[model samples]
Target chain A: MDLAVEVENLTKRFGDFVAVNEVSFSVAEGEVFGFLGPNGSGKSTTIRILCGLLSPSSGHARVAGLDVWRDAERIRQRIGYMPQFFSLYDDLTVAENIEFYAGLYQVPPALALARQSELAEVLELGPVLDRLARTLSTGWRQRLALATSILHRPPLLFLDEPTSGVDPLTRRLFWEVIGDLAHEGITVFVTTHVMDEAEHCTRLAMMHYGRLIAEGTPEEMRTEHVQTMVEVQAHPIWPVLQALEKAPEVVEVALFGDAVHAELRCDLNDAEARVERKLQTAGVAYERVVAVTPSMEDVFVSLARRWERPTAAGADR
Target chain B: MGEPAVSAQGLTKCFGAVCACQGIDLTVAPGEIVGLVGPDGAGKTTAFRMLCGILPPDHGTARVAGYDVVTQSEAVKARIGYLPQRFSLHRDLTIDENIQYVAELYTVPRDEWQSRREELLEMTYLAPFRRRLAGRLSGGMRQKLALVCALVHRPEVLFLDEPTTGVDPVSRRDFWKLLHDLPRQGVTMVISTPYMDEAARCNRLAFMYAGQVLATDTPDNLRRQLPGELMQVRCRPQREAREALKRCSAVRSVEVFGDRLHVLFHGTADPMLCERLLADAGVECLEQQPVEPSLEDVFMSLVSEHGLTATATGNGL
Candidate 1:
């Protein structure tokens, strides 16, 4: 299989702080690779290393088969990056922005114009093509930003939470466009806060405190990390939650909709019995307690428990 | 149950020629959470502003905290807490000072707010950061401090407008746990979020689009309302299966979920039919099973039925 991105023992530091610490991962050509981590977890730093925007303090990376140590300039040309917040020209019309990016990316004139029409059609920006971007809503701007980033038809894309604040419908469309690009063999390296969107990635790697903690397909990660989770539905959920919190077998308890999703440290039957006993002791009326497939949210939340929280006295940074 | 914590009927608001929100009917029972779910220009903020008594509705009746939002807006305002999207925590102020300022703004007696402030700070894990200047805090900490300030008055109803849009997964999880604990303390909440997970957390959701509420129901009811059974099929080289599945007449829609396809059938979903199709298409299917429809699945279907376009006219209504 052809590799699109490769990293080995990558590390970056700012004085005493290690931003990306000895991380390693690889993405296959045409794969939708998701990078998952909490804030300050070195996700952006790793992306910068791979995109060749920032030199790694140590170790190595290759983007589009070019070395980051020696071929950053060429790597930049092979990748398109859309950030968490896009800074599109407010004064530029949707079409104007596309045309400008076309020139900036040095796409051939005719090919640029052709891709412009194609992207406009794909993103469904035809009606508002002439409207100034400032007047466009968030969804429109996001689409325009995506269009601009890929105007050069780069084989690889780096999208940082592309659907962060987008409405569900527009967000769905964004993923569809991404899927289409991946199908056409454009490798996508992306980060997202929304868990469902992470499911769109062909494979994923999770980061915590500058270290790669886990890597696999969504299903693999779900089962391996957080075993069968049980969602308990009880009236006056507070008491039930309190009861479950004290239960011995309940590893983690979170509210999933109106239900209390309890991660267990034991077999399903033992855990369920323990949960029932506690709820009964608390006199909470429960609708049901059933084992559930742990969502990516559950897995991530379980994994995100590395909160060696900084106190006022300790927070001298 | 004698009176709803909040209720609205035929809520309409317009800005110039743009009808931001129209003919909306929604109610929040005491101790219940109702979320306004929509994309940009979906008029969630318009309706929210009207409900909060900050913006008057063009044509509507809304009673918040048992007081008319228009005729008795002052009374309503006194009984509610609002955390807008761009909540400003004074950078110069320490976390404690900011909370004190907000308390004074609401004119809560010093004695009344001190305990609540302490409790709020403790719950959000912000107590340790009390002496830290807001400027020195991370984005997540600032957001938590803002929430603590909002809750300083201990209002009966709370309004949070997309409180965690860009907050990281861990912070978001922490923030949501805070939200879940509110109803237990007798505080009803009304929030707006573009995220499906947040939407699911609500007791009821109003899915808004193009300035209208497409559906208002509990997440469970909403999920169950989908007409046909759903199946998740995992296959290698998933794109081929997706294209072939799209051609299958029995399949209503084939949504790509990583390397799996969520096949929503036109009628009763047949797993054998999918396997046969994949077998004929020369695509290898590893696993196939009927699965519960996710909130996104139900929502995407709603958006499709509503005919809301992707561009969605990003007009800031």
Candidate 2:
């Protein structure tokens, strides 16, 4: 299979602090790959390496079939990156920013105009094309940034939380462009704090404290990391929460939208039944205790919790 | 429930030609957490400013903490705390010093704030790092310190503007635990958030779009109000299937949720209709199942019917 990004034993260190530590991952062409973790988890370091912005202290990485170390300049030109904010020149008009990127990427004058109009139509930037970038609101600003970055039609796109502060409708519209771009064979490497947005990725990998702790299809990650996740409906939630927290069979439990989600121990064959038995003995009547499909956030949280146990003593220090 | 901590009617604000808030109506009973949710430029922040006594509304009236927002702005401000998004406290100051500065600005007595500061720090688990510089703390810790400062005055009502927009999932959940505790202390909260999952955490929600509220209800009631049942359609090469599903007359709206297409139908979900549509388009269907509509789903469909789904021309968050 063709690959868009390949990394092996990649590591980066800033003096005594190791940011990206022995990480390995691969992204197939046209896949929407999700890289998620907390802010200081070093996902950013790995992304910088993959984008050819930072050299690894050890190991290797290749982008668009070019070695990141030897072909860093070429790799930089081959990928599109939508940064955290309005990275465009604030004084430049929407159209001017697009033009600047077109020239910077050295797109042929003839092809640039066609690609500009194509992306304009896709991202709905035509009406605001004349407006200065600084004057645009959150939704329009994000769209313009995304449009300008991909003007060269690179093979890979790196979107850093594209819809972080955007509304639902605008986020949907933004993802529509991302969804279509993936189908057009442009690999998308995205990082987002929004769990549902993470759900759309073709595959997801989680980083924590400079290590890749979990990687798989969302479904696989959910089942493998989150054991016997269930949503329980009960009255007077506070006492019920306290009751479940003390139960040995339950690993973690928290309130979730008028209900409580509990993760039960996997060693026991009947995890759900164990929760039911515990609740019954505690005289905590529940309306239902149905197993739930753990969300991407749940999987990530569960992974983070499990990763924390082994290093709880000295990792943070 | 006692008198509402916040009440508004026909509140409106405009910045030149742009109508930041058309007419917003909302209420928050004492001890309840009410969320003003919408897309960026939907006026969540504008509405928030008006209620917090920072910006005067162009029309209508609002009462915050039992004080008229227009005539008694100062009194209203005194009774409430507003935590703006990315709140930048003096980064050079220690956590305790930052809290002291805010307390001084609010004119909180030293003796009053001394005990309050200790309580807030203890509640948020920031007591151990009270001497840490704001710049040295991590993102999550910084937010908690900000919260401690916001609560230093012991206000009756709190206004939080997108508090967890960029926080990682695990930390976000931890922050929610802190928020959930505030209500028990009789601190009513009005928060604006772009995240759908976070909306579910509120006691009530007002869905906003284009400077107007579309609907307000509990998350459960909001889901039940979706025009039709939700169908999760999984298919290989999702772009074609997504387009095919969108084109189908029976589907009210189609949203890409990770690897699956969440199809909201006009009435009952027609499985065979969807199958035929994908087949005619040469797309392979992996699985089709009935799934519950999330807060995002409900909000998207709520706005799609307004025909504002593709329009990025809204006011401001």
Candidate 3:
């Protein structure tokens, strides 16, 4: 498979603090690869390394099949990066901002203009082209930034939390644009904490404490990590949660919306009966308790909990 | 709801020609967590400011903790804890000192400071890091400190604006747990978030779009508004399956979810219809099942029904 991004034992350190600790992953061509982690999980660091903005302390990385360290400048031309913070010139109009990035990327004048018009149409930025970038809403600004990033038509794009604060509608629309780009053979490497957005990616790598904890398709992650998930809808959920916390068969429990999602070590039937007996003994009334598919969020929570227990016990030792 | 802890009637706000919020009505029963959810420029922040007495509504009235927000702004402010998008904790100060400063700003009684400080720290799991500089804490830890500072006075109501947007999953979960614990103590909270999952966690949700409240209901009730049964289809060559399904007369909408496609039927379309369509198109259908509509599906349907463009508009600018 032609890889758009490849990392081998990648690590970054600032003095004693390890940011990206031996992280390794690869993205196939035309793939929508999602890098998911909590804040301070070294996602930004890894992206920066791939973008040639930062150097890794050890290991090797390649973007667009060029060595990140040796071909840093070449990699810059082959990849487009959209940082978490909007980096466009706020004082410039939308058209001017796109033109500026186009010039910086050294696109021919005629080609730049043509690509600008194409992007404006695809991103629906035509109406806002003459408006100052500063006056645009977060959603519009993000769309403009996205347009600017892709003006050079790089084969690979790195978007760091591009839809972080936008509304659901804008997010969906943005993903649609991304999907279109991927269909056109542009590899998209995006980072996000939102599980739903992560689910949109063709593959996902979940980071925690500067390490890649899990990586796979969302369905695979859920099935492999979580055996049986029981969703309990009950009034006054707190008491039920406390009761289930002590149950030996319950591996992990977390709130999912108004319901309590409990991952059980036992099969669905045994777990349901055990949970029912406990809820009844505790005098808690439930609307429903049924086995359900674990969402990506549930899988992450379960993995994080399991990861923490051993470390927490080690701390006691 | 008996004598809502927070109530607004025809509350409106405009920024020059932009109507950030228009005739918005809201109510939150005591001890309930109501989420104000929408996209950027949906006026969630503007509505929050009006209710918290930071920005006066241009029209109508709002009351927080029995005090009119416009007429008795100070009283309203005193009874509520407001955590804006930017909370402005003294980054140079230690977590302990930041709490002390906020307590002083809120004029918390000197006699109650020590115990209240300890309690808030313990509640947020910041007790061990009390001596750490606020700037040095991780994104989640910093938010926890901010939460602790916000609760220094133990206000009856809390207004949090996108409090967990960029935090990691573990931290986000921890933060939600903190918020979940508050309702039991008779603290009413109105939190604004762009996340559907977080919105689902609320006791009630107000879906805002284009400065208007589209709907307000519990998660289950809101989901019931989705017009038809959602069928989860696992098929090979997803793009082909999606296109084939879209051409089918019975399909209302086809959404891509990872490797699978969620097809919403118009009315009660038979599952066999989809199977037949895919088979005719030569797309392999591995599995199919009727599934529940997620909050995202419900929100997407609602937004599209309202003729709101998921794409950005320059009208506000």
Candidate 4:
């Protein structure tokens, strides 16, 4: 595969804090690559390093075949970045915000005008062009932020939690635009807390305490983390969770809304049957009991729990 | 029975001629967990501000625990705990200091401040780090500290505006657990989130769009509103499957989700449609499954319905 982003022993630190520790990963061209982790797990630090905004404490990274550190200025011109919170001038109109970013890219005046018009249409910002950024809704602000980032038509894009506070529909809409960008061969790298969003990425890497713990496609990660999961919705969730916590077949147990999820190493079909039988014997009236599909949440929970496992005896991944 | 914990009637807010909230009516009962969900600029924050008495509505009326928001703003402030989208805690203060400051602001009894402080810190797992400077804390820790401050006074009603937006999935889960535990203590909560899955945790939910409430119900009810069959289409050569499905006349929307495509159709549209399209496209598949609608599905359906109208008004879908 053609590499769009390449990292080798990438390390970053803030004083004694090892923000990113000898992490390395490669993203293919035209792929949606996700960086997944808990807050402060070095996701942002790594992103900043890739975006040429922050220098690594050690090691090397390349974006689109250019060394990130040695060719920082050149690499920056070909990559678009949208931070966790965009720095848009609240007083400026939507059109002005786009114009400012375009000017920063040093586009010719006539071409800039055409680019601005094209972006306005693509992002639905035409009507709101005259409105101040502060007056736009949170979702619109996000759209405007995305529009500004891609205004330069960079070959690569970096978005950190771009859908953080936008509604699901808006998030979906945002992903659609991202899909379009990727289709046009723009390599996209994004960090997000939403697991469902992970499902949209072509490939993903999960970090924990500054280390890349797992890296794979979403489905692959799910398969590696969850052998099987039995889902049950019952009146008494606490008791159900407690009962499953000690089950030999159960690897992890979590509460999903009102439902109790039991992750098992046993076969899914057999585990669901056994779980139902056990609940029945315990006199639990469950609204539903079925084999649960692996989700991004299940994968992360399993990964987090692995560290908490007592006596790493007889453990198999 | 006498009055709902929070109630709004024809509540609207406008900036000059621009309408932010357009006659939105909502009610939250005592101990109820009501989720206010919408994309950005959906006026979720504006509605939250008006209900908390921080921003006066341009028209209509709102009451919190029978206290009129307009006339009894102070009383409303006294009885509610508000955590805005931005953390308002002083960065210079230590975790304990921040909690103490909020306690003092609420006029929490001097003698009880220490105990309340300890309890809040313990519940949020911040006891060991209580003396840490708020500025030095991690993103998740800072969010937790902000939440601890919000709960230190034990207000009868709590308003959290997109409290878990940028935090990682694990922290998001922990924060929501705190929300669930509060209602048991007789504290009603109104939380705004852009996530659809978060809606599942609430006793009731309101989907907002363009300053309007699109639907209000439990997650289960909202999911039932999806108007057709859904299929999770997985196969080898994923891109080929997506391309083929998009051209099929029966498919409504073919969303590429990681290695699979979420293919939605108006109705049954033939179960063999996926296989036929894939075979014709020469795509080899691992598997495909017909699945139930997820919260995101419901969110997408509503947004698509609204987008048709929103686009009609110059926004373009």
Best by TM-score: 2
- Give the TM-score (vs. native) of candidate 2: 0.94
Clash-forming residue pairs, model 3: A38-B168, A167-B39
lDDT of 4 at A85: 85
Best-to-worst ranking by lDDT: 3, 1, 2, 4
Computed on C-alphas against the true complex, the DockQ of each candidate is: 0.52, 0.56, 0.53, 0.39
Query: lDDT at A98 for candidate 4?
Result: 88
Q: Against the true chain A, what TM-score does chain A of candidate 3 give?
A: 0.93
Residue B67 local lDDT, model 1: 96
Error of 3 at B271 (Å): 3.2
What's the lDDT for all of these models?
0.84, 0.84, 0.85, 0.81
Give the per-residue lDDT of model 2 (tens digit) for B1-317.
66789999999999988888899999889988898887777888889999999999999999999999999999999999999987988999998999999999999999999999989988887877788888888888888888888899989999999998778887787788788778878799999888777788787899988889999998889988998888999897788788878888888888887678899989998888988999999999999999988988888888877876334555533
What lDDT would candidate 2 get against the real structure?
A: 0.84
- Flag regions of model 2 displaced more than 4 Å: A235-239, A246-249, A266-269, A276-286, A309-317, B309-311
Query: Candidate 1 residues A1-317, lDDT tens each?
Result: 89998899999998999999999889999999999987778898898888888999999898899999999999998899998788898898899989988888899899999999999898888878898888887777888999999999899999988887677766878888888899899999999878878888889999877999889998898888886588898765666777787777777787776678888888866766777777877788898888888989888878766333344331221
Give the chain B TM-score achieved by candidate 4: 0.91
**Tens digits of per-residue lDDT for model 2, A252-310:** 77777667788877643576677788889999888888788877777777778777735
Q: Which 10 successive residues of model 2 chain A have the least lDDT summed?
A: A308-317
Encode model 4's per-residue lDDT on A1-317: one tens digit a residue. Answer: 78999999999989998999999999999999998987767898999899888899999899988898898888889999999889999989888998898899888888889988987777667778897887666677888999999988889999998988776656776887887899889999998888888988889899887888899988799887778887888764555765776777778776685687778878765887899777777666777788877778888868865653254221110
Which residue pairs in candidate 2 collide?
A167-B39, A167-B40, A199-B258, A200-B258, B41-B316, B41-B317, B45-B317
Regions of model 4 farther than 4 Å from truth: A235-252, A264-285, A305-317, B234-269, B272-289, B308-317
